[model samples]
Target: MRVIKVVFLFLLIIGVLVLSFLRPDDYLWLSFILALFSIVFLLIRFERRKMEARELVLLAILASIAAVGRIPFASIPSVQPTTFVIMMSGYVFGAESGFIIGSVAALASNMILGQGPWTLWQMVAWGLVGYSAGLMQKTKLMNTTWGRIIFGIIWGFLFGWIMNIWGLFAFTQGGNAVNMKSLLTYFAGSALFDSMHALSNVFFLIVFGNNWLKILTRFKRKYGLLE
Candidate 1:
């Protein structure tokens, strides 16, 4: 059941991407609605019992800060590490909260900047980052500092790869336009930004990952989240 659900979710996201190409102009609004709907539905379904209203508010505010941070300092060509850091909301909060924060941040930031198909990509891409991070947080290996550093680096690079691929597919003019030359150019252009982003992830993880985890664990204990 879990595997089926994951596959279905992937297919749903891909279907949206496919639809975006077919109706490029309408993709933003559609993406916004879908992302919001998913966030709200997930929130109601998962966190209603675990978190209070205040924590939920905190999650949104954190995501908003993250979204704003990305807009002014978007990764030069593609891939934004700041975006991945925001996705760490899942690690701090929970999967549902992380997803909501990521999705809402993307939607809200895009609205401020004027929505486009890229907004849709941003929403899905960042949301995936948070979701993946949240999932990693669940794994036993994520308990130690080295584990987090490794995970952060791996996921940061993953975000870079995913964003670059999304750019190729989402912005490419027809399938033929994404040739080796263009792909290499795009990859090279994006590499520097991704490097910085990945470095930032590593730095941030080293500096504050344990502290944030402690805070979350403390909060969970106080709030009886485990119960």
Candidate 2:
């Protein structure tokens, strides 16, 4: 199952890379279709593993917390606690669990907030944040205070950049594909939102990161879940 997840993950990256370069103008729906399939496939693989009841329960709790956590921040533009919570989940649990939690959080939150083509991109971006945070746990990046701080800051911008792909695709105003000028202008306009995202990440990660990790780690250890 791990092998399958890794293999599919590799393929997913390659798919993104290919479409990024090729970007067949008329074939945009294909990206969403592929993403939907990939997400579904990942979930199926997760389920097929005969996930423990406790693990499922834990995933649910985390996803719900991440989702509901975003609601109160709606008035603050891009500032939100969702990424902070999801990133911690990934950091302690490992990549697959992080991705699942991140993706589910996006989906669940949008149910209250509203959904659109953008939701899928958010699911992917947030999932990647958690997924990468989990992967970083094995590296020196997660070892020190500054390193983790840097991680949160970087993903703040990265999460915005990921969503920008959808913006470019959808808001190009019939340009059909992104051009250098439109892309630059769109990104420039979004800079404030992205900056807000990155700064908010640093704030939450710096202030609440350690405690959240300790609490989550304690729960994991007590339950012997995600082992």
The true-versus-predicted C-alpha distance at residue 44 of model 1, in Å, is: 6.3
Off by over 4 Å in 2: 1-4, 10-50, 174-177
RMSD of each: 3.2, 4.1
- What would the TM-scores of all predictions be? 0.81, 0.83
Residue 147 Cα positional deviation in candidate 2, in Å, after optimal superposition: 1.3
lDDT values, one for every candidate: 0.68, 0.79
lDDT of 2 at 214: 90
Locate the minimum summed-lDDT window of 10 residues in model 1.
75-84
Per-residue lDDT value at 86 in model 1 = 61
- Candidate 2 accuracy as lDDT: 0.79
